[model samples]
Target: MRSWNIAGTLDVVPAAERPDLLAEPVAKALRELGADTEAGVVEIDPEVADTEQFCETYGSPLDASANCVVVAGKRGGEVRYAAAMVLATTRADVNNVIRRRLDVRKASFAPMADAVAQTAMAYGGITPIGLPDDWPVLLDTAVAEAPEVVIGSGTRNGKLLVTGELLASLPAAEVIDGLAKPII
Candidate 1:
C-alpha cells in the first residue's frame, strides 16, 4: 500500500479489514469500491468526533482533515439535498455556491434529525461516501487535491483515511473550484 501523508498517532489499516469500525453503508460502499482500494480506517474516541476536537485529541492536522456537511433547500414544495466536502481549515459556501448550484432561493444546513435519518449515518460522522445516489456531492477543490485526508467513517468511533483523488471520483461527486472559503 502507498504511504499516506497523514500525521499524528493514527494507526490506519485497510478499511476493508475493519468493517466493524464502519457503519453499514460505509462498509458496503467500500466493499463496492473493490478490495484493491487504498482507503484506510482508524478507531477513534467517539467523544472527539467533531473536527476540532478530533484533530486536537488524535493529533491530526486540521488541514489534513475533511468534513462532510448536508445541505437542504426547497423550491415549489420539493426539497433538494446535497452533501458538501470541505477541508477542516475551511467552510462550505452553502449560502452562495451551494444554494446557487442547487438552484434554490435559499439553502442551509439540513436539520440534524433529517440529515441523520436520510443519510443513515451518525450526525457527527457523516462522510461523503455512501450518500444517497440522488444527492449531489459537492467536493471542494482543495479537499479533492489533498494527498491524504481524514474524514468521518459514517460512525463517530472511527475515521477513514483516503486520498483526495478517491473522494473526487465518488458517485455524483462534482469538484468545485471555490466550494469552500478559508475560515478567517
Candidate 2:
C-alpha cells in the first residue's frame, strides 16, 4: 500500500490516488477546494471502518477522530439538508441548535438511503469536505480548531487525515459554536 505522512499516523497517500469507491463529486470537490495538500487518504480494512474499530486498529486517539452526520429539516413544506461535523466524543445538537440554524420546525438524521444517494458517499463514510454546495455544513467550533483529525474519505475502505482549518475552508463550511454537545 502507498504511504506518506502529512498529518500523522495511518499510511496516507495522495488524494488523487483515492479509491474508486470514493464518489466522483467528492473527488472533484476535494480538488476544487485544494484539500489534497491539507488532507491525505489511507486505505483501511472495510470491516473495521466504524469510528471505534478504525481508531483502535490504527492507534489514533478517539479525540482526534471526527464524525460527519447528515441531517434533514423541514419548514412550511420545504425541506433542507445540512451536514454536521463534530468530534466523535460529542453529539451534534440536531433537534435544537441545528433546527434553529436551519430555521426548520424539526430536524433529524437523514434516512440512510437518502443520505447515501444525495451525497454519493457510503453510509458510514460521509465527510464535511465534499458536501453538496447547497447544503450548509455546520462544523463544531471544537472540531474546526483541532490540530488534526481523521475523517471519512467518501468510502468505507478509506479514511482522511486533515486539520480543522482544512475542513473549515471547504465550500459552505460554517464554524458554529455549540454545534455539538458533550456526549455525557
Candidate 3:
C-alpha cells in the first residue's frame, strides 16, 4: 500500500489558513452510520490536479471512491441547494437530469471558488459529511452499495476515506440514479 500523508501536516494553501486537523464531522457521520473507521488528516501536495493523480497519490481505490458534489438550482435568479454523490469514475450531469429533479428553471455547477468560500473547503476537495444541512442531499444509488469509499476532506490536499455504509448513514442522503456515463 502506498504510504498516506507525507510528514505530519497536510499541504494547506496560504499556510496560515490551515485549520486544526480533527475528526469532528467525518467521524460523527461514520459513527452515525455504524462504521468503525479511523481517519488521519495531514497536509500534502495539492490532491486536486486530476482524478488519476487523486487516486494514485492517495492510494485510493479508483473504482470505489466517491465524490460529493454540491449542485444548485436557480429560480428567479436565486440559487437553491441540491447535493449529489457520484462515483469517481463518473460525472454528475446537472443540466438534463438534476435540474428537473431539483424543480428549478435552471441548474448549474456552482463556481469552485464560491463553493470553497462557502463550505470552507478548497475547490476539488468538498465532502458531504458535514455539508450545510439545508440542501437536499442525494447519493448515487451505485455508490451506496460499495464496501468502502473515499471522499473529500474539505480541502484539496487531504481526503476523508470512509466506508460506504458509513456514508449511507447521513440522514440527508437520498439514493438517486444517473450518476454518469463515460463517453467512449
Candidate 4:
C-alpha cells in the first residue's frame, strides 16, 4: 500500500479499510471495483469540504485537487445529466463543450437540490465514483493525467485520494481533451 498522505497533514488510509469514512454508495462502489483500486480516504472537517477551503486547511496542493460538478441540460422536454471532473484550478466548460457533448440546447450546473437529491450525496461532496449509471462521467485530460488528486468522498466530512487512472476507469467515464478551462 502506498502512503496517501498530503503534505503530511492528512492521514489517508486505503478506502476499503475505512468504509465508515465514505458515503454508502462510494463505499459500495469501491468494494465492487475489487481490492486493487488505488484509492484512499481521510476524515475531514465538514466546514472545509469545499475545494478552496479544504486545500488551504489541509495543506493540499490546489492543482492536486479535483472537483466534481453535476451538470444538467434539457432537450425535447427530457433532462440529461452528467458529472464533470476537473482540477480545482480550472472550471468546467459547461456552456460550450459540455453542452455540445450532452447534445442539449444549453448546459448549466445543476441546482444544488437537484444534484444532491439525484446523486444521494451531500451538496459539497458529490464524487463521480457512484454516480447514476446512465450519467456520463466527463474527465478533463488534466485530471486524468494527474498522478494523484484529492476529491470529495460523497460526504462533506471526508475526502478521497485517488490516482487519475482510477478515475478514468470508472463506469461511463469519458476522457476529454478540453473539458475545462483555466480560471482567469
Candidate 5:
C-alpha cells in the first residue's frame, strides 16, 4: 500500500476491510481502479461519516472535504443521471448548471433508493470513482485542483482521501468552472 500523508491526521486503511463497503461490485471496482493505493481509504465510525461530523471529529479542514451528489433528470420519457462533486463549502448548481447540462427540463437529486440501487453503495457514501460508466461525473474546478480532499469510501464506515487532480482524472469525469456555487 502506498503511504498517504493526510495532514498527519487520518489513519487510512485498506479499502477491502472498510465496514460499509461490503458490496462486492463496489469493492471490485475500487480495486480495479487502483484506488486502494491512489486514493487511500480511512475507516471511521459510521455515525460520523457525514461531512460535518466527520470533519469536526477528525480535525480535518472543512474546505478539504468534498461531497458527491447524484442528480437525475427526465426528458422525452428518458431519464438521465449524473453525479456531481463539489467542496463542502459550495453547492452543486443542480437547478441551473446540472439541469442545463443534462439537457432536461428539470433536475433533482436522485432518490435515496434509486441512488443506492444504482451505485451499489451506501446512500451517504457514493463516491465518483466507481460510478456507472453511463453516468457523467461532474467535478467542480475547485474540487479538481485542491491539493487533497476527503470524499466518500463507497460506505458510511469510511472515507476516501485523494488529490483533486486524481479524482478529476477518473473515467467520465468532466471538470467545469462554476459547476458549484458558494454556499451562504
Candidate 6:
C-alpha cells in the first residue's frame, strides 16, 4: 500500500508513480498555507475521459466535486479564453453565463492539445490554484457547501481532495451559479 501525505490529509494514489511538485498546485499551495495532507498509492488505474465517467470511478456523488476547466473561443476570428470551476452536477452555460463573463461573442471548449499545452496542467486534472491569476475563475455555488471536494491535482494519476472553503479563498475566485443542470 502506498500513501501520500499532503498538508495533513490522507489520499490514495497509484503506486510506482513519482510525485511532481510542479504538477499539483493545490498540494503545493496547501503546504505553503500550512495545511496537513496525506495520500496513499495503490495499483494504477485509468482516468476517466469525461465528467460522467470521472464521477463513477471515484464513487463520488455528482455534487461532491468541482471541475475546473479552461474554455477557448473566438470572436471576429480572434481567440478568446475563460476559466471556470463548476460543480460536477452542473454544466457551465457558455452563452448566458460564461460567454458574458468573458465578454466574447462565441465560446467553446478548447482543443485538448491547446488546453494541456496552454494551461500547463493535465486536462483531467486542472486545478485553480496554479492558474494564472488574470484569468477569471468562476466557482459554482454548489462547491461552497462541500466539506471536501475532489479537484484535478494537475496530474492524471491523482486527485486533490480539499475543503470548499479553501477553494473559495483562492487568489481570484468568484462564486456564481448555474454551472450544472440535471441531465434529462
Q: Evaluate all candidate structures by whole-model CA lDDT and list the values in order.
A: 0.90, 0.84, 0.62, 0.89, 0.84, 0.63
Instruction: List ranges where model 1 is wrong by over 4 Å.
Output: 35-37
Worst 10 residues of 3 by lDDT: 7-16
- Candidate 3 regions exceeding 4 Å error are 1-19, 22-44, 47-50
Between prediction 3 and prediction 4, the one with superior TM-score is 4
Off by over 4 Å in 6: 1-28, 32-44, 48-51, 74-78
lDDT sort, best first: 1, 4, 5, 2, 6, 3
Give the better candidate number (2 or 4) by TM-score: 4
Which tens-of-lDDT digit does each residue in 1-184 have in candidate 6? Answer: 3232221333454312435522655455556655424322221233563556766664556566678878776777777776787777677776777887777777787788987876778777777766765766777777766666767767765566666777777767777777645545
TM-score of 1: 0.96
lDDT of 3 at 82: 71
Model 4: runs farther than 4 Å from truth? 5-8, 35-37
Q: Which TM-score value belongs to model 2? A: 0.92
Model 2 residue 19 distance off true place after TM-score fit, in angstroms: 4.5
Question: How many residue pairs clash per model?
Answer: 0, 0, 6, 0, 0, 29
The best candidate by lDDT is 1
Encode model 1's per-residue lDDT on 75-157: one tens digit a residue. 99999999999999999999999999999999999999999999999999999888899999999999899989999999999
The count of backbone overlaps in candidate 3 is 6
- What TM-score would each prediction reach against the true structure? 0.96, 0.92, 0.74, 0.96, 0.91, 0.74
RMSD of every candidate to native, in Å, equals 1.2, 2.6, 6.0, 1.3, 2.0, 5.2
lDDT of 4: 0.89
Tens digit per residue, CA lDDT, model 4, 19-67: 7778888888888887324688889989988988988898989999999
